[model samples]
Target: MKGWLPFAGGMLAVVLGAVWTLQGLGVLDSGSVMDGVTLWAIVGPIVAVAGVVLIVLAMRARGRR
Candidate 1:
C-alpha cells in the first residue's frame, strides 16, 4: 500500500495539471477564472513535470526494493 501512494498522488497531479494547463490556455474553457490565465499555463507544466518525477522516483524505489 505504501508503494502505491506516490504513484496514485502522481497520477492525480498529472491529470489535474493537464486540466489546469488546458484551462489556462483557454483550450478547455469552463467559464472559470482560471481559464486563459497565464500563470496556470506556466504552473501547470511544472506541476505535471513534478508529478512525472515523482512517478519515476516511485518506480525506481519499487524496483530497488
Candidate 2:
C-alpha cells in the first residue's frame, strides 16, 4: 500500500498534466479549459504542483518506512 502511493501520485500527475497541458495548449476545448489562458496558467500549475508534492511526500514516506 505504501509503495503504491508514489505510483498513484505519478499516475495522477500524468493524467492531470495531460489534461491541463492539452487545455492550455488549445488541444482540448471544454468550458473554461478554453475560456482563457488564465485558468490553465493558474489552476493547472497549482494542481501540478500539488501532484508533485504528493509524489515527493510518497517517496519520502516509502524511504522512511
Candidate 3:
C-alpha cells in the first residue's frame, strides 16, 4: 500500500543508522572504510532520529485514514 512506503524507508534508515553507529563505536567490526570513524557517532543518531520522524509521520497519516 502507499502508506507503507514511508514506513519501509524509515525502517531501512534505522537499520543503516544503527549499523553506522555500531561501526563508529567500533563494535560491529565490518572492516570497511567507515569502521571506527568518529564522525558517524554523531551522524548515525541524527539519521536514526530522522527515520523515527518519518515513521511517526507515517503513523499519523495512517491515523487520519
The lDDT leader among the candidates is 1
Across 1-65, the per-residue lDDT of candidate 2 in tens digits comes to 68676769766975686678668766677876353465664566667777777777778878897
Q: Which residue pairs come into collision in candidate 3?
A: none
> Which sections of candidate 3 miss by over 4 Å?
none
Candidate 3 per-residue lDDT, tens place, 1-65, comes to 65689998898889888988998988989888888999987788888988998888888888887
Q: Mind giving the per-residue lDDT tens digits that candidate 1 earns over 1-65?
A: 55588888888889989999999999999999999999999999989988888898788878887
TM-score of each candidate? 0.92, 0.62, 0.92
Error of 2 at 60 (Å): 0.4
The C-alpha stretches of model 1 lying farther than 4 A from their native spots are none
Clashes of each: 0, 0, 0
Using lDDT as the measure, what is the rank order of every candidate, best first? 1, 3, 2
Superior by lDDT: candidate 1 or candidate 3: 1
RMSD from true fold, candidate 1: 0.9
Distance from true position, residue 60, model 3, in Å? 0.7
